[model samples]
Target: MNFLYPGFLFALLAIAIPIVIHLFNFRKFKKVYFSNVQFLKEAKEQNSSRDKLQHLLVLACRILAVMFLVFAFARPYIPLETGADPDKGNLISVYIDNSYSMETVNKEGNLLDEAKRKAKEIANAYQLNDQFQLLTNDFEGKHQRKLNKEAFIQMLEELKISPASRTMQQVVNRLQQEGDSRKNHLVYLLSDFQQNFVGTEKIKSDSSIRYSFISLKANALPNIAVDSVWSLSPVHQPKQAEQLVVQLHNYGAEDAADIPLKLTINQQQKAISNLNVPAGKSVKDTLSFGGLEKGWQKGVLSIKDFPITFDDELNFSFRVNSEMKVLTISGDPTQQFLKSLFAADPYFKLREMAEANINYSTFPEYSLIVLNGLKQPSSGLAQQLKSYVQNGGSLVIFPDLDAGAAVYTPFLTALSLPVVQELKTGKPVSSSIELKDPLFKDVFDQIPANMDLPIVNRYFSYLERNTAGKESILQLPLSQSLFARYPAGAGKIYLSASTLRPEDGNLSRHPVFVPLLFKVAFSSAKEQPMYYTAGKDDLLEQQKTSVSANQSLVLKSTDGTEIIPEIRQTPGKTLLYIADQLKKPGFYDLKRTDSVLAVLAFNDNRRESDMRYARDQNLKDLFAGQQISVHNSEKDALSLNIEAKNSSIELWKLCLILAVVFLAIEILLIRFFNKTKNIQKP
Candidate 1:
């Protein structure tokens, strides 16, 4: 038991006043001659006894009333927990969830707003000099330092919803890192308790810090979101038919029908489609649009959804080049088959160069580089090809008939590919194509078993084992690799074991050669991702090009937010990190001064779109062995069952009620006992 103001207990001494007054009642005695002695004797006995009893009873009541009144003013209470001293102040840390999920509104209005209101009340509950800290989802610089009461309140007022998200465990970890372990620490968490964000397993029960969870739950409602978007073709072609596939998800219980989806390119409406999504499921629909203009174009795929508008619109950026530049370096310029293949297609701009005259500096300008019948692979050319592949350029290698193992081994080793071991010269071996591969997808409805396959007579075998990124696209008889594809860095390598000469079995003149070469050229162009998530570590790779003396790259968002990100020059690519600059989801432009270099789409994290929330029981289970209590946001903070000294059970109100009851009894006894008074007889 304790008193908030124990000095007021001296008022209990005032009970002596009632006790003294009851003991020393002074009255003038009037002597009267009574003739009837028998009647007088009986009346005196009865009246004297009743009068004495009433006096004692009233005295007890008056004394108790005074005592109870003094005790009430003292404001005594029982400490909720006896281990801690009530006089000691607390080190308080309050975490308010300010993620996109906090935008939900209920009767108390926005959850974030309500959380701030409750947080302020919590701060007011503590003493002014008590240490305080404020934390949010952003984990900003301000959150690291402790603030005074006034400063903490100001921070709470300035808090807003952010695209970033942190789990419950993260908040606890942050608090632990910044909290004062020596003092009695208290953490008050106010949030909607989204289930995905509740990573309580990462939290350990700490005896030093007490936790209080204030759950702010809104009405459960359904939500629809544009999960993602992808194009039918990986590479974008100018003035060609393209399909944009939009993926939709329903996080509700009911089915959605006839949901209108619109696609816009370069601020112009391109295509629209209607989709039906089932409850707790996902669906994908394709939007066909043609006449794609050359150069960079910003595209947006949008749909109508209630409440959650963040994921309603999906933005993406793509480019359609005027023509695909093919740089073919040949040991023999008389190889007409190599020239005719690329020259026949108008979409392909073929530039043939002798192996000796090839300039490595101009390699980044081409989408695909062909190394045709190179008699010997020079160390300089091998190093240049390695840098080119790393910077997102495709390479197709056809070994010369007399090519040496030593000439190409160093080049293969640099790119983490298999080296040439030995050259085989024998009867023609038929080719077996991988029909279900993405390269051959939709190329043929069904492959004919008896179809004429390409045959290789003279070929090179591998010296090293195949890597995880290496896949055999075409296999020869006796399980030998005819054509293998190896992914090196951001680019790919298509290596054929056989030469392209007539003596090498006419693989270059086969019908399968045309589409195989075309697919390699088409797929070489780097396809930009449909969208990137905000608050994630993402780097946008741009092709390295010759810039003017004063030109520099800059990033600008659709909302007029811009920043010059740190540019990292790697070999043949420019890497720009936009994770820090992507505060919100929208279209952002990578430009050189005023000229837009590339368009990049960013979307908010869809993890918050799910409406599921952690229940009170779930939280309790999460902190089972810890000193924690959970309550609804709308309830009073002080009303919850907590271990803090501020939660003292006040006995003042109970004492005040006892005081009133005792005074009433004292008055009734005085009034009733007076009726029996016999002053004349005495």
Candidate 2:
């Protein structure tokens, strides 16, 4: 047993007062004449012996009462085998889960409110001088420092529901960083313990710190969430048909049927549908909409869900271009096939440049660059095109058959494409087409058995080596590739074996030429991510834009919240660091001074959408090697439990009770002894 305030033990000296009073008779004896009778002598002897016994008994009781009283004031307690010493000041770190999932209700009310109450109770269990650190999912800078009891309680009152969420390990790591090393450290985590909280692996904890998990329980609730969404069309055009795919997930045990889903674009209703999602599974549905103007389109997909509604709606954004730009760099001035094909439609703005007069600086402005028989391709042009394709641009290469292998080998090698080995003069018809590939998907309504495939008269056979990202769109006899698509970093490269000359086969004028080239051109438009998660996606990436050294980019939200993110320029893109700035979900415009550069969408993380919680045993198993305790939320009065766990068994209250009992014994002894003497006299 240890004493909280050992200095109070000095009060034990007061016990000497009772001993002195008993040893020396302080009261003056009154001389009486009634003591002369011989018969009273025998009674005097018996009374003298009984009187001495009663005096000794009364002194012992008085001494014990004083001693017990002093012990009570000293606050004695037995130290538990684990945890910090109760005598010293403690640094307690309490983590309250204020995530979106904490909005769930139980018998005690909302989980977040219950967590706050329990946190206060924990603080009350300790001394007022003990320091406290409050941590939430936001991980604000103010929470990093320690606060006194009053300040900690004030901060707790100000906390509300936040969109941010964290795992168990992250909370532990933050707690470990706080507090003083000399002081005893104790941690309390109050949360509903969602399944995602445990993360993928076991938790790593410090052996010196004692951890207690107060698991708050909630009623079982069925939940359905809008998991994700994506556009089927890679490129968006004005007044064009577009299909969007939305995924729905049912986290409940029973299947959900006829869940109403709605899609809105620019504050106008676009499409509506109903879906059936199975238990613990996901289902996808497609919505078709059109007539979008040439501008930024803010799209919102929503579903009707109860109890947990944060993840019911998803926000997304995309851009619809008014015209597609196509650049053609031709070695032969009279190569009019591509120029005439694209010029027929006003939607395609075709720009033709000769080999010697090509402007290299304007490569990023076009959606697709068509190389029409570039005779003697230079190393500089190849390097520029390589970087363009790798940075999400699309390119088509029609190699000049008359050019030597030495001139073309270096250009093809730089782009990681197969080099031409030898020219074949025999006419070979195309064998098969990859009809199921995404490039050709939905292009053909029906396949004909006697379809006319592209024929090649004189073509170069490539000496292929690496076939990792190569997809053969058109194949010749003997498994030779006539045309294929190669995935280069973020973009794609389409290579054809023959040029657009009359001497070559009719591939340039074939029926498949129109759809094939148009599909590639349409796919060249860089498709940014439709949406980003609020907390998870802190970095926003965009195509590199020229910004003056004095000017800065600002992300302005719909509600007039603006923030200047840190910019980081890379080879072909710019990265903006938006750490913890975005909390709400909606559309935000990236602006340069007065002009809007792009529209970015953000949505809340859906990890908190699932209402499933981890069991006590599961948490114990996660922290198997650590000294952790799990508290049940059903039990009220957490202060007593915390006091017992943190400081071990306290004996001060028991000492006080014993002190009262001894005083009562002293009173009874004096009363009984005096009654007996009076009875003997009668």
TM-score, candidate 2, is: 0.90
Instruction: Give lDDT per model, in order.
Output: 0.82, 0.87
Candidate 2: pairs in clash:
none
Candidate 2: residue 529 lDDT (0-100): 93
Highest lDDT model number: 2
lDDT per residue for candidate 1 within 1-682, as digits (tens), equals 8886789888888888978887788867898788888877877887888889988999899888988888898888787653444456567889998888889899989988989888888888777878889988777777888889999999887888898867788778888888775666788898889888885473664665778889998877778998888877756778888987789999888999998899989889999989999999999988899888788878888899887787788878888877889999999888888789988978889998898787888998899999999876787888889888987889999988586787778777876778888888887778888886678876777778788878888898886585677788988876678888888877889998988888987789988888888888888876666678877646876777556657767778867888776677776577887556567877888788778878887788888888889999899888877777888887876555545425456788899999999999988998877585554543
Please provide TM-scores, in order, for all candidate models, with all chains considered together. 0.82, 0.90
For model 1, the stretches where C-alpha displacement exceeds 4 angstroms are: 1-88, 199-207, 410-416, 449-451, 537-539, 544-552, 569-573, 644-682
TM-score of 1: 0.82
Single out the weakest 10-residue window by summed lDDT for candidate 2.
673-682
**Candidate 2 residue-pair clash tally:** 0
